[model samples]
Target: MPLPTDTYRALTQSVSAELASLRASTPDVMKAFGDLGRAAMADGALDKKTKELIALALGVAAHCDPCIAFHTQALAKLGATRQEIDETLGVTVYMGGGPSAMYAASAIKAFDEAAGATRG
Candidate 1:
């Protein structure tokens, strides 16, 4: 279920409209959440870019597709390179992520099964 990067643009736009409606329905909660986002993202010890990178890593690790789309879209707007994205995902995997689980499975299978025979 790989999505094209451009799909993120559409996803962000669609989610923005839904968020507006959500705010209308849950004004207090939405306002609080928005406030939290703004406060957290404001630059202090870390810049916004770093925060977004962290978010991207967390999103990938958590398997949150929408989070990935939103963060990648943000990173793109912030001038993130392919290297940055790749490194971020690399860190995410290093930190024990869904990607790590996938690779770990393959590693175990490879270890258990040689070219043609199974091992103990």
Candidate 2:
């Protein structure tokens, strides 16, 4: 099932604040992390959209709720379709097993809710 829209919205807001605090409190570390993330997601052998999907799958495998929400929102903004997400979830489930399957569902729910929030 998809996450409640309000919950997804709250998670996004909370994460933004947390990330901001991390940047303020640990500028050096956060800058390094941010630079690596930017480089990793930049176009090359794998495009930005594909990297986002991979990140989403990893988030599911790791059972990180905030990561899931953040990546899902990024994927949506990058024009990822439902079909692509479904296929990515299939691979994530296969590689990560039963627990990942459950988290994949949660990721999808969060994505749907986030997408709605964006539209509104």
Candidate 3:
């Protein structure tokens, strides 16, 4: 729920480890992933709102709970409303089916708790 700074750092470190492993095994693949990440961040056709929505959907599709939670928090910091988050998850459900629905709900709960902590 309430994600502490340690938890966030740990999650990011774990993801970094995974990426490092992938880079060791397939440098080209890792390069592509880096390229894509850079491209996503670059100002282009998709604005911040669209990019965050896409990130949320991808996080759901990948079933990465940490990613989902993190992005939801990020979106909220960017002033995304509860309704928007709910609708994004709904779209995730449409794309990823039932399992994604469950994960999305969990992600939402985690995000809500984390956001509440910041508010207090």
lDDT, residue 92, candidate 2: 97
Candidate 1's TM-score reads 0.73
Q: Candidate 3 — what's its lDDT?
A: 0.74
Clashing residue pairs for model 2: 2-109
TM-score-best of 1 and 2: 2
**Which tens-of-lDDT digit does each residue in 85-112 have in candidate 3?**
8898898899899989887877677567
Expressed as tens digits, the lDDT of each residue in 1-120 for candidate 1 is 454334555555677877898899999999999899999988999998889878877776776656766676666666666666667667778897667555333322222222122112
Scored by CA lDDT, what does every candidate get?
Answer: 0.63, 0.87, 0.74
State every prediction's TM-score relative to the real structure: 0.73, 0.88, 0.67
Model 2 / residue 20 / CA error / Å: 3.1
Candidate 2 C-alpha lDDT tens digits along 48-116: 999999999999999888889889999888888888898999999999999999998888887887678
The clash count of every prediction, one per candidate, is: 0, 1, 0
State model 2's lDDT.
Answer: 0.87
Show where candidate 3 strays beyond 4 Å: 1-35
Residue 51 C-alpha lDDT in model 1 = 94
* C-alpha positional error of residue 92 in candidate 2 after TM-score superposition, expressed in Å: 0.6
